[model samples]
Target: MQQIDAKQAMAFVRQRRDTTDPTYLFSDLDRERRQQAFIASVSHQLKDAGTFTDIGKMQGVLDAVSKNIVVDSDLNLIQLAQQATSLTGGNISFSTLPITGFGTSPDGASINTVDVKQVQATVKELLTPVPLAPVPTTTAIPTAATTSPAAPASEAAPASGAAAPAPATPSAPASNVYADSTGALQGGAIACVK
Candidate 1:
């Protein structure tokens, strides 16, 4: 639940650029160009960012740059944001929703696109927990207990020639864990023309 301001994020992007183009202000880049450049730049930086979350830093990079930041969560987002900022030091987890497609705009601005329907489905799948293989455990098997006969007619077994049914054993429930398709935090290469 951490975020970097657009200007600072862009600064990181600029530092990572390998362009041979003439030096120019970051502002000079078109919106689409800035986004493309940012993605290309940070794709590698993400890996080296290191772990900032407990258990693990779930790494996720945006496929496209955003001009605004929104605090949306299962809990009161504003309260969560305030609490997060108030902490002197806290863990950060990165998560990404990637593009499923890409195309150029009519204005010649390179654009990255996503399928909203597909994304909705993917989001559900990504959030849903999966069952981990059950760990095999062994326990003592039950032994039949001996009984003493008191010659009580009412307590004696029925003489209908029927046998008693054995008891049924219970099984343990399957263990479930969240899915981690991205594997580990690592730098990835992005191809682009300066």
Candidate 2:
């Protein structure tokens, strides 16, 4: 829950472990997770601090970004700013592509390997819209006079003699190694990286 300057923020996101330290195994995936977590933290902080509403602060941020980053020649800053407003509401989310396993490159460098087909399928699934569950319709209960006695188990079986489909089970939530925590100040929470 500590506030950091620009340099500190950069270091926090870009920091990597020393391969010589056997105590902790280094993974590029972990570094990427840290970067994504840092972005979320910054987004929360900016929204909480009302930096977007402050023209001076916004201009200062824009100046820094413009000087440091190269954008497409056709890119419009105003349009980008408008799109960026979505971040203020904390609607942003990040997910990493699943890696198959770790492997050594031809150069003998360790790397994360991913299945191309699986990656494509995962990306497609992520982009696809999920249909909403249908709302249940209510039915009137039959009166005692109108209702008949329950049928025997053998007679109640389906005409096709097939069993009824099982109910769908909900999937478990994904585990995140990097979690976020609230800051001491009024500003938004900072990401707690592992």
Candidate 3:
């Protein structure tokens, strides 16, 4: 952001006077007032862009008023302060203009102030990050109680004969290997032996 120097500012004032444009009327102020306006304009742009809240809080002043006041992601804030120092004779200081909402009726604008609740909530959230809950673990094999048991043989009996109680099929004793081999391996472990 190239700042208008005293000479340049004077030229701008002259140009405005000759062109009948009032927008540039303030370009001819004395050094103190000119510097103040310059600083204010720059600060206004920075605030509008959300660069920093108050100029008072600016860390490095010199870089703030430099060749490029643009606050893009790649812009270096330190450099901006250094530039500011070069422009305003080190007398320039950062300040957040007091905000109280004053503008035209329909189209309004404000600066240097934000919702207190919003700011507090944001700070609180940052200070205490949320913790994630632990993920649950599930067993691969379903337990008898956790799963439905097979229907009784009588209930599954053929329509006519009552199924003879399914031939009294004896329950197999539980063993390490027997339990290991599921129904798909009914031929015993040897059936899986290569």
By TM-score, the best candidate is 2
lDDT of 2 by residue, 16-60 (tens): 675677788767877888898887887777767766656666667
Candidate 3 local lDDT, 1-194, one digit each (tens): 66767688655434412346656433222333545566566656555554453344554432543333423334444544444333333433433222334234445632234567766565554434345444557768887854877567656555585645323344432322333333443221112221
Superior by TM-score: candidate 2 or candidate 3:
2
Stretches of candidate 1 off by over 4 Å are: 1-10, 13-18, 21-95, 98-101, 115-117, 131-194
**Over 4 Å off in model 2, which ranges?**
18-20, 54-56, 129-194
Tell me the deviation in Å of residue 173 in model 1.
16
Ten contiguous residues with the weakest lDDT in model 1: 58-67
Error of 3 at 100 (Å): 36
Alpha carbon lDDT at 79, candidate 1 = 35
Worst 10 residues of 3 by lDDT: 185-194
Which is the winner by lDDT between candidate 2 and candidate 3? 2
lDDT of each: 0.42, 0.64, 0.44
* Decreasing TM-score order of the candidates: 2, 1, 3
lDDT of 1 by residue, 26-83 (tens): 3323444555545444433443453212113321222121123321122333332233
Angstrom error of the Cα, residue 113, model 3: value is: 40
Off by over 4 Å in 3: 1-29, 53-194
